[model samples]
Target: MPVNLADQLKQQALAQGFAVAGVASTSAGGRMPLRTAALERWLAAGYQADMAWMNNPKRLAVQQLLPGVRSLLAVGLNYYVDQQQGVGVARIARYGWGRDYHRLIEQRLKRLGRWLELQQPDSRWRVCVDTAPLLDKAWAEEAGIGWIGKNGNLISQSHGSWLLLGHLLTTCELTPDAPAIPLCGSCNDCLPACPTGAIAEPFVVDSRRCIAFHSIENRDDTLPLPLHGWVAGCDLCQEVCPWNKHHAKASTDPELQPRNWILQSKPQELKEWDDNQWDEALRSSALRRIKPQMWRRNLGCL
Candidate 1:
């Protein structure tokens, strides 16, 4: 008997270190309109901050990303590690505590894309990580991998919101999974727990007030005083969520483990390091995304 393509792909994704996998059709129906409307509102409210690319039309429609797209293979990698926080060290988000996930996830996506091409030789595929304009969380939920939580992160009953997401868009027709239903019933822990109050409402995050945005993406020399202590990204919202507290599991992939320096170095220690040392310490690490100058700027606030 011939193997089921979707089943084989799901098994392959698990072999590639993905914790969850699901398929979604590219056809615009169901919740796509509502998701687009929410995005438009978010953009209009200036909640995206300097991320003007959030307005890209390609994000509103999967077909815009790859013409003739028929199905999307969504995969989530668990990057959560149960590590103790250093007493006075600046914090790095769990996702950035290890190797750059874009590199890690994209490599797996490309491999999966190649396998998919072999299964359907005539089909075309595009692998997308964070580099693309696609709404990853929306698609992840649509693909049945998880539900989008009040803090705007995709939450899985088994893996929580500590997932690094990636997708492979292909022209081949595949069975689509039913969308995941919202599971955050009456829980509003993440909203009040956010240090900067970025979660303005359920399922809405105001990036202008987001500590993670300032720590990682904001290029300004100074961050707002309230957004201190976060050297790379913020995990407060995820940390406070009941789902994460109960369901988050430590990742098994060695590539996702935190480097010793990232886990131990204090902000003062990081500030004293020279540029060359910074490069050496954070090489191939996601923390490298926050340039040394930004590190100094973030440290200044602390």
Candidate 2:
């Protein structure tokens, strides 16, 4: 059983629901041949707003997150569905339209890790989704899953931007994939499409102006006036991308489908909900992090 097990592990990942998987090593200071200047420029412009976690230089660097980490195995799961657009109901970002990706991706990674263990008992492994200190998107780009587009989301030639990135660091020295080529080319559609102009440049994103940021991480009882009517996370950028026009819809996972009422909720309707009602509607949703008051703040904006 002295095989290069990364290949088998990746196949298992695809079989387990991941659409794309690749491996790289971890060390410190983010991915080597750093993309720090672009990051620094974005942060210095005060684009991160209250999400101060992005300011941590170490968090911006992969090497610091896992010292002596030799490889990073990156995975992308497609979350798009056929009914991407509809009538009367507010749209949820395809990624969040299902069960929380953190739990979903972790569950699959754990299974894949166990499979790897059976293949190479001596290999050491660690799995990470969004919450980890490591920058999952950067590693995904390095691992060749896709290239980061102008809107700062990884866009695949085949899968477009509706991807959830996950990370796995292992001690084994598997062959790494060449970084994915930038398929975005000269497209600047995301720049003009953003209601708030969050995409400052081809590869830089000003999170402070991002509706997804205001709706998810920025938890103030009221969103800044600049971001209103943002119902949930924003998808204008993704909606306009040519590559996503014919994007494939993934098999549905029950937990990810929105509650009937949630899909049908209106701005005024959600604003009238009491705290208890809010809890019932978003009970197990990633939106729970926004809190009832914050939900009210979002609805009031609409």
Candidate 3:
């Protein structure tokens, strides 16, 4: 029997450490318009904060991102780590506790893209991570990898909201998976759990008030007085979600494991580290993006 290319591709993705994978049609015949409208409203309300790239035209449609695209191959990597930060240590989100996901996931995606090209030599492809202007969570939900939860994170039945998403846009036609239905019915736990009130409403996050946004993306020397203690990204919303409490598990992948310092260092000790010491400590870790100065600033706030 001839092999189904889509199935083979999905198998390859799973072997490459992606916990979940699915394909979605790029024909623009489904919920994309609704997503676009929601995004437009969010941007209009200044919910994206200083992330102006969210307004890029390519984000609205797959065709704009990769011409001749026929299918979207979405994959999820679970980065949940079962560990606790030491007392008086700055809290970092679970996602950033390990190596930078972009670097690790992109390598897997590149391999997948190459394998697809070998199977269909003439097909064009584009691999995208978080840096791209693509609406990855929406595409991931559409592809059936997971559903978007009330906290705006992709929540898998098996992985909860601890997924880091990536996707490939290709010209090769593939079988589209069924879209995932919203599974966060009546679960408003995340909204009230957010310390900064970032989740203004179900499925709507105002980045201006997001701790992750202010800690990681805000370039200002001083963050809001209320947002402190989070040295990197924030996970309070996901931590409070019932799905995570039951479904989230520690990732077995060594590449996603947290660094020793991230899990056990005291904030006061980190604050005393000079530039050279900070660089050595973080090295290739995702928290390196916060910068030495920002690190001190965040620690000072704590």
Candidate 4:
């Protein structure tokens, strides 16, 4: 029985545990031009902070990276957990609460890519997650999975901005979905929610002043700003967004649920952790990026 390639691929993606999936065009215009131009302006402004890798030329050349590639299949998984850290504890972002998303998302993408090869033996596909040289959020939105919120995260109509994004570039030329439209309209709740004025303006997050950026990426002798109890990543903007506050559903994915170690640990405990303790807590976790000295540095900031 013949079936629509795009629909079948999306079904396979959902069956692979993705909450939402859609296809997007890799052709000129239709959001790609505007998205890349905005990125150029952002880079010119030095908004990427110490993350110099944003200058990767491949990021804007997804269309040319893979020969004959004509579409992207964007997928997102909801990672929201209702649990909140207690006072004096490390305020890790919900995205970093469980295991490493890179591994889990990569596994899912690989499985999807395998299914694609089975469908079309001659097809070529590229699986990408966090480290890929692509403007993932833009591609996700263009795929209709969600809209990019004023807070700089993809906001799904069903799952809000608490989504982990990944996508595949394929030569299959699947039918594209209508791009998601911005629905934040006049609502500025996420702006003032940022403690460090990181939301320099709507839709632009200056990483230099972002707590999550500083806590995870900055490695200077002393933190330049206040932490407000965050030792890993901050969640204030998402926590205050109306879409997340009112519409976000708690994810049931076991891999994304809050871990007991994170639930029980405090800042002081993290500061006092031995080498073995640190490794145990962060093993195979995205939080592993916060090395032992980084933990001490972050705790000292508080």
Which of the two candidates, 2 or 4, achieves a greater lDDT against the reference? 4
Residue 85 of candidate 3: its Cα lDDT? Answer: 80
Q: Tell me the tens digit of each residue's lDDT in model 3 across 1-302.
A: 12488899999999999999999988876677788889999999999999888989889877888889999899999998777788877788888878889999899999999999999999989999999989898899889989988899999998898899999999999988998888999879999889888999999999999989988888888887455567888888888989899998788899998888888888888888999998898877777788889888888888
For residues 1-302, write the lDDT of model 1, one tens digit per residue: 13478778878999999999999988878687898899999999999999878888888878888999998999999999878668898888888888889999999989999998888999999999977999999999999999999999999999999999999999988888899999999989999898778989999999999999988889987776466578788899898999999998998689988888877898888889889998898888878888889888888888
CA shift of 239, model 3, Å:
0.4
TM-scores for all predictions: 0.97, 0.91, 0.97, 0.97
Is candidate 2 or 4 superior in TM-score? 4
Which sequence of candidate numbers ranks them by lDDT, best first?
4, 1, 3, 2
Q: Give the TM-score of candidate 4.
A: 0.97
> Model 1: runs farther than 4 Å from truth?
1-3
Q: What does candidate 2's lDDT look like per residue over 133-159, in tens digits? A: 666677788888888887888888778
Cα-based lDDT at residue 222, candidate 3: 86
